[model samples]
Target: MGDGLPDLPPLFGPVFALREGGDALARAVALAPEHGAGCFVWVRAYARVEAAVVLEPEQPLAAARPALLAAAAAMADALAALGPPQAEIALRWPATLVVNRGVVGAARLAAPPGAAETAVPAWLAVGVEVRRALPPGVEPGTDPGRTALEEEGFDEADTAELTAAWARHLMTGLNEWQERGFARLAGRYLGWLERDPAQAGAARRGLDSATGDLVLQRPDGALTRRSLRAAVAEGVA
Candidate 1:
């Protein structure tokens, strides 16, 4: 499949393709310990655009939150590059992409549970899937919030092109994350967050000093940390 397609972009040079389809997550996790870092796996024939990146673990997986956030920010950057206007695209907190107010796709990250963050991880995988085409016979307004690129008039974007663009953006994000800090990444991500009623009456939108979690400070001076982990687990912001 990908053989007949055009070449992948330069940034994704380390990609490896799988011949059989069993479990991409298992495959990625199994291979991560060997290749170490920057190893990627891509499956083109599948229904989704899937890939993974490897990272060494230094501390426990829970402590790896900042790195996970960095990877997520990287994915958001990748999606933004394909837009008609750069930075106009953004991700809803907890892993949803809202492009021009429409859902383009989603990104998922994985690693061994209880793995260390500061130490080289056994392996880390970040997979992204974009709906290039809609299920046949599906009509608009049937699902107002759900959409594919084809439905939104992005006919020019093939899977390969999107994959390449994502790879480039991801690398840029990771580099920036390592060089600068999460402050910039967090700022970019915060700009794209969709407003929710749960955050009304807060001193600020969602700023928390403790563990960098989003918090709501009421007029009564009560501060509660908005559980981003729970939000991510439920796939909502």
Candidate 2:
């Protein structure tokens, strides 16, 4: 590889470059237990960006959901920084990232399977993938629901720069969560969620303070909740 990803914070450990077609998330997961924490793995795919980082946390697995989500936010922020002005970046609940209302990519989290909610996982991996360019023969606007960075005027953005930016932003996010609180991280994430004014009043949505679950209030005062942890776990599988 040797694209020379930019220098990251000291706490981010070392970068492991994977050849094209390599799975960054799987590599990070396999190396995490041995590397302990802070190791990052990335692959510069032909038309996409993929990367994952290992994390070792003192808190229980349940409480760590916010940290994983923060990583996703960091990735989104990094892309936004490099993307064209008014790119209209937004995040779907839990992990998906959209630009200009088109699905560009998503983030995912993985931990020791069947680990108890209150137990500290041996390791946690946060993975991110973004579409860098449309595949050959694919035309823009062919699928209004899907898009790539190139199609969105992000010609200046590249996988290596995005990888470096993500690391820095993730470090900042983790520090914010530790020093300030999850509320601070949560506010940023909530603000980026795609919202519709038409849904206001008739029903409302918010995040649960403790578990990071999506809480929806119905018109009849009934409440429904969806766990972000469960969402991440499912995505990992």
The model with the greatest TM-score is 2
lDDT, candidate 1, 1-237, per-residue tens: 244334544444355666434344455677777766766676664335556556654444544444445555555665555544533465665667665677766666676677543444565676666666667788765777777666666555566666666666666666665568656556655666665566677665553322336666788898877665566456552
Off by over 4 Å in 2: 196-205, 217-222
lDDT of 2 by residue, 22-43 (tens): 9998999998878878898999
TM-score (all chains, Cα) for each model:
0.76, 0.91
Give the per-residue Cα lDDT of candidate 2 at 191.
72
How many pairs collide in each candidate, listed in order? 12, 0
TM-score of 2: 0.91
Worst 10 residues of 2 by lDDT: 195-204
> Compared to the true structure, candidate 1 yields what TM-score?
0.76
Clashing pairs in 2: none
| lDDT (Cα) of model 1 | 0.59
